[model samples]
Target: MGIRLSSVILIAASVGLLSNCSGIRLRQPLRSTEYDWRLFGGSETRTNAAPQFLEPPLKLVWSYDASAGFGPSALSAKDSVLFIATLQGELQVISIKDGERLGWVSLGSAIASAPVVDGTTVIVATADEKNNVISYDFSSARKYWKRTAGPVESAPLSVGRLIIIATLNGTLLALDRDTGEERWSIQVSQPIRSSPASDGERVFFGCDDGAVRGVNAITGNLLWTARTGAAVFANPIVIDSLVIVGSLDSTVYAFHVQSGEIAWKYRTSGMVYAPAAGFEHRAVVGTAHGDLLCLDTRTGRLLWSALGGDAGGVINAAPLIVGNIVYVGTLDKQLYALELSDGALRWQTELPGRMKTSPAVFGKRLFIPVENRIVLCYRSTSGEE
Candidate 1:
């Protein structure tokens, strides 16, 4: 298949311009007591780390019925507001503090990718027959524009003044954040199901052809391409000068962001489909064989592997790191909180259904979306809350 582009005119309106295109800017300065999960992987880099410390013995804060089942789309939050997209073709805005439905709008298609929040605007990509990317103004409940980019299962990245999205047909489209106008587009050789990660200057993503690519965030020009052992299904995690990603060939590869040189590669026992979360000196990732491995961030050497009878389930969700603890969801319907230093199990909780969506953490609360239509909020009992 080839790349196809079309622009669909929706309700349009003028809005406040972004401060700059360097990256998404916060409406208010981030306070010490407030944290927002604004991107698919928590940020453009997709590290999936929470800013605050969250301890175990979590209490259920609230539960909201999604009406339709949740898919691979993760949740995004800003200023205590949660943005949830469902397979039922609905974009809902809810209160993070209490599960109240603040606002909602029908997108008219199934949404498998997470929505990105930039100030008062919400950007999302849909997977229905239209395969449209739409932006809306939350405050006014009006859509700024909608453009058909192709079939997109991957989440969109809102950086600077562009909304970057990759289609299943291997085309990466960069659209103007304010007008939804096409800025630039790049086509690869294979499908891109994994979400793209960015660091403002460049965007990184993996393809089904076993290639991890880097592109200029502004011009959509190819920067570098690194080949992996097998198809790359996990989102790339960009940290410092390296781009780290996992492949279905059971190996995790790290490439230099600038030169695309192989920094290190670690082989696992099973396919690595979930994205890796990084901390100080260690990176944590889960495998299909039900093992959680912690590796040296610089050397890719295995520091410790949490296996045996304790960790035996398929983990498709990326690990959530907060302080010294790592949280991961497994297909066995369990959520495990492990120590980041040694992968020791700190706590475990059973869920109502399989947990494939990564948990969203803010303040002292963790929001978990299950395969069922239920979204559960857990408040850390520790003094931090």
Candidate 2:
């Protein structure tokens, strides 16, 4: 389906951008180096870590009602706009300054991931299987290329000129970012609910086989595979030459990126579903049983663990590491911020609905994709921007 554009209207103190799916294409801005939340886990490392800082006492900057539920993907920010995909099958663009609908186009009947911005084109993969993967160029108001990879439930990882994605059928396809041609492919022969992560030289992911495998990003050659106790649904994070991930068996496994040797494995309170996040040297992860753990990235030593007290809720999304704060959201509709050094509870915000998608940030603002079909933006009112 082509785009059904819309117009942004001036309303009150804030802009009014409702869910009409209007009829005017907005300006397609170029990719900016200032974007810190442009990908699923923010970067190819799948760390969900940002160097930005924002003091508390944040006020709600703006909120945009998308009128559709979101999947396990994230909210991506590129330049002046934001890209989000709804389960109702539309890729929407919104104003970051003020939550206004810039435009939207039908990506498929179902989408479980966010759109990855590649310059003027937005790369998105649909779980609907018909339009499996598509690169739509909003600058020209047309599709750059389309291909059927598989029923992909994760966001496509852009590695330079290649677009990488994982199919539920266990096939990982690496396509040319410019022409949508196949560059490389890998078959794990098991369901890959976890998305792909990279450390420039190699790519990493988890599988249903309870194995965390590392593959060369350039040649698609299998590097090494490390076994775990149960299925590995969380994406692995590469930091300090170690690939760290969590397994459904409630264990966090860390392996050497090159040798695939087990560095360490620490058990959690419950099974892990979301990916792990890291900032400087500490990596944080949440569990289905409402456990938030911070570990040393190099040694896998437990720095501190936040059990099911105030952070009690099933965490389906990864914790975001912004500056020294660990922002965690749960299915129980609460957003908790923990101090990264000691796991001290800084504060928790009450929301209207469940938050299953990971939070993203630019500089001083926080963008959260609440499951109630709305995106809430909060910025520091203390002039930290």
Top lDDT: which candidate number?
2
Best by TM-score: 2
Which ten residues in a row are the worst by lDDT in model 1? 1-10
Reference-based TM-score, model 2: 0.92
For candidate 2, lDDT tens digit of each residue in 125-149?
Answer: 8886666798877655566798988
Q: Which tens-of-lDDT digit does each residue in 92-195 have in candidate 1?
A: 76767688775566676788878988766788898854638888665554566889898888889987999998998889989999998899999988999889
Estimate TM-scores for all models: 0.90, 0.92
Say what the RMSD of model 2 is: 5.5
TM-score of candidate 1 to 2 decimals: 0.90
